[model samples]
Target: MVSSAAQTPSSSVEQARQEGALQTALALNRLLNPFKIEVKVLGSTAHLRGEVENEVERQLAERVALATRGIETVQNDLKVNAELIEQPLERRAYAQRLEDATLASIIRARLLWSTHTQAASIEVDSREGVVTLRGQVSSAEAKELAGVLASSTEGVYLVNNLISLSAADMARLREEHQELIADPPLSDAWINDKVQTSFLYSRNLDGPNIKVATQDGVVRLSGEVVSSEQKTIAVEVARQIRGVRGVDADMLKVATKVSG
Candidate 1:
């Protein structure tokens, strides 16, 4: 048999490992991750201390802790406060920063994929939904198109276009354009993702209410929109995506308002 001293060290290590696993399980839960919840494990019992939005959430946290493997009992010491439902200011600010970064990336990809603006060297920056475009384009039309694309993207509240017209390298521009043309066709999955992203980013469309599917370069839209004009706009948006051979919006219907 192993000595008691040896067993003590091994047991301690196992307890620490179990503590870390319990903490991770709590953090991964969407409802509990935002709150500052503390977990401590001793033997087979887990201790939880934190503030949750309500009793339901408190129970949820306890259930999650108990469900963890090796955790047989949970000492739930979480307090219920309605105010805890509101996210902390730091969390909100962090989320905004992430949104701005994502918006900038999307606009840059849009410019790169557009045949008219792809050759132009454009820089995109976004802050709190406002986008700033800078760089040089070969012509006035290209510069204007870049600004329009940036403004139309979802989450963009405003656009500041500072692109200037300049004489571009003709040979390099030609080579880039030819490369785009020679590239292989986009896959069906790629087309579907882009189309869905376009709907989500469009300011005038109800993105969540719309469903998009693509097969063989043909896009099929099924969803409800408030007006006929919105339906038409949805079809046009899908058609404009790169590699989309056709858009079929026959199934997309206009929602009739109910009398109050």
Candidate 2:
């Protein structure tokens, strides 16, 4: 029989969600929430405490905790039940497996550090030496290389590559990028606007600040040219054939007179 707490509340759905989580947590055993794990319920805010077997489990616990009716926020205090200092020698074995999988997925063919390349994008999950790779890659070479790199790493018994090509296929990926200049959809414009805003706000230069403008499809950059490097970068990036158009830089006037 369902408890009274599980019964549908006359309140809003959000309130129901908060109530549901608290009821569920109370029903579960201490091993589930543990002593270190503290759960706080403040209207819609949910705070979580304690640790779990792995990150996946930690996240799962958070989801369960949030199911309660009034939870607004969740603060996770769940530590990864590391095998080193804790009990149950079996946990140590499991930790080693996870560590190995993380290492294998991040290792490149010849790169020394796992972080040097874009390994963070790749998700690694493993049971023993079996590793599962989930993500997208642009090239067949990249796909094949991903597996080989994972297999070559120590402790990886097998690799399951779940990579799929993005919408931009290999043959036209480079060329298709150029079309952003001719007719941009709203999404493209929003992205460009964000980039331009960030660039303008950055404090990396000192002088008569450069000006950047975009119209219809063309980009016009006007300001005192600081250096050949800056001029080259401005022209190339502002009107890159990929997303933007021809660079109209004639309006730019290099400062020829010093301020008195």
Candidate 3:
């Protein structure tokens, strides 16, 4: 999840510094392109290692890493394979496309399981090594966290975060969340409709693969999800629905090896 920049080190100066550096490293992950990027932060400087598609991607990685809060310098040691540079354009493009698609899937799954962001509301798309995030996010912290997650994905060259806030009125949203806890929304029927709708629209959820049933404001999730992450997200989404008194996931089935 996203948060405001760590304050200038105070009494916990050393601790803050360490955390800031780690955060900066995590933010740089989205710049990776088909190769694992390792980040090591030392004070205000970050060391970047691993392989990249080309000099351009390597430079882009460093630039993006520098933009992350709490880092001023980047020590780039990203190596570019010369053999790939000589390959035909179509071949290179095909390889990149395949890698990008895989990267997008992994990133989307991670976001779904993230505690800091609303995975259902965020959409991940990748093309030509650039990742784009679109859809609605509830809070600014989630928005920032989404971007950072995209940056850290494998084979991601550039990230364009365009997830807008769904709620323009944060105060109203906070009140609604509070009110739902105190006095659920409407009735069981209303809650069921909203819960099912949320699942149908989620980016990471396999909607058709799962079933939703509600009675007396109790949500019961059944059927199968591709991953444990999806199962977790499904439960969280149901709970977030207004008027949900309780959620029963015991009936929900998760496959150990889901492939489609």
Which of the numbered candidates is closest to the native, going by highest lDDT?
1
**CA deviation > 4 Å runs, candidate 2:** 1-195, 198-208, 257-260
Q: Return the lDDT, model 2, position 71.
A: 56
Residue 199 displacement (Å), model 3: 1.7
Q: For each candidate, what is the lDDT?
A: 0.81, 0.52, 0.68
Decoy 2 TM-score against native: 0.29
Model 3 lDDT, residue 249, Cα = 85
lDDT of 1 at 85: 50
Best candidate (score: TM-score): 1
Per-candidate TM-score against the hidden true structure: 0.61, 0.29, 0.35
lDDT of 1 by residue, 33-125 (tens): 667888877778888897887898899998988888888988899998888656655665665676678789999987776556777778899
Which runs of model 3 end up more than 4 angstroms from their true locations?
1-184, 256-260
User: What residue pairs are clashing in model 1?
Assistant: 154-201
RMSD of 3: 19.9
